[model samples]
Target: MNHASAFDMDAFRPHDHGRCRRAARAAAERECQARGLRLTPARAFVLDALLESHRAMTAYELLDRLREAGLGKQPPIVYRALDFLVANGFAHRVERLGAFVGCVHGADDHRAAFLVCRSCRQVAEAVLEAPPAALTAQAEATGFAVERVTVEAEGLCERCRADA
Candidate 1:
């Protein structure tokens, strides 16, 4: 499911986040139902936390939230939920930051590119229609099949630039 090829810059600007969060939640519910996956309370809570902001959150931060919400105090609790969310494509792990964020575009397994704000740590997701030609060629030369690709570009966002 290819969406608009344009880069998604919603995280850098102010918008109706309530609508975004609601839509993402609804999408997750529908996906889970279709896939026969159980969206347990703890998993739902973790998804909600990740969707609360575009900022990536570390597992420890999520664990803190879970503990405060009286969900579970153990590290494994959060890890398990994260594993489910990621495996089901409802969330993504930002490897550069060692954190997680909700799938703003829903769960289509689309190739993803991220624009990360170095100052505020906000991340904007974009759809990468295809891998770079050079990379593909290089991989072909080496007889390596490309399975997945995630691009992360770091820079200051509009607000951060203005402040600077």
Candidate 2:
């Protein structure tokens, strides 16, 4: 997976998950409205499914859900929706797993860092105020223009650790 290190397991800690999902959905809706973006059926459904859990979900997994829901069986439908969501900051890709997660923080300025659960594969996003120092220095030294960056950490979550 694309990762720099491991992290604390605060994401797997208990809270009102249903409430969190609702809040996330509401935020997405608000952001879409503000930006004049379309929260299309396919895109909204995909976001809802991802937000149902903190886990990163593969395209195949999500495609199955879409098929069962009769949204669309074609891969392009989901792929296109994913493209829009990721481009608009409504969703993010967890490159390590080649999966996607709904962005709960709405469209914000912070860069996303993640604590990834290796067992369950649930990801909790952390906002970084700036790029990591090493990457910044490297880019500057090379005169390379950095457009985007994703920082991820992998390890077990509390539940997985307990299970072990």
Candidate 3:
């Protein structure tokens, strides 16, 4: 599947969560094997937890899930898994909220932009081909080499706006 073009928001809501989780796990496994990376038990479990929900989750929230699953009841366990996932491009950290969200776009390196729903904490991610021209130009003018960029926009989602 073309990860970038295949993304559909409707598929993420109130559907077969089990299938979604499985597909994500399978994708990760395949990608890891292709890249010679080890997807340890803890890493897999944490990835599964994030994939199970489209909503972004804090590290503490992920720790609770790890505890429930008998993975390990320590903060370092979750952090390590998170670090590995983020470093490998399997996950992205929402700097605005200090939380993590799985990369639904498979495990490829791409610029990420997020539409964050503040009220419900739902996060939708899109893979960007390049940094915004404005940002690029500004960086060039300042002689700053831009490596990676994360653009996040925060607002209430449709449901939240309607509720208000």
Which residue runs of candidate 3 sit more than 4 Å off their true CA positions? 1-8, 11-19
104-159, model 3: which lDDT tens digit per residue? 77777776777787877778777767778888889999999998777877887777
Question: How would you encode candidate 2's per-residue C-alpha lDDT over 1-164 as one tens digit per residue?
Answer: 23322332445877678877887889888888888989999999999998888889999999999999999999999899899888887788998889998777755434678888889998888666677878877998999988877787788887999999
At residue 119, what lDDT does model 3 achieve?
Answer: 79
Model 2: per-residue Cα lDDT at residue 48: 92
Residue-pair clashes per candidate, as listed?
0, 1, 0
lDDT of 3 at 72: 94
Clashing pairs in 1: none
- TM-score on alpha carbons, each prediction: 0.93, 0.88, 0.87
Model 2 clash pairs? 1-96
lDDT of 1: 0.88
Question: lDDT: which candidate is best?
Answer: 1
Residue 117, candidate 2: C-alpha displacement in angstroms:
1.0
Question: What TM-score does model 1 achieve against the real structure?
Answer: 0.93
| Residue pairs of candidate 3 with colliding backbone atoms | none
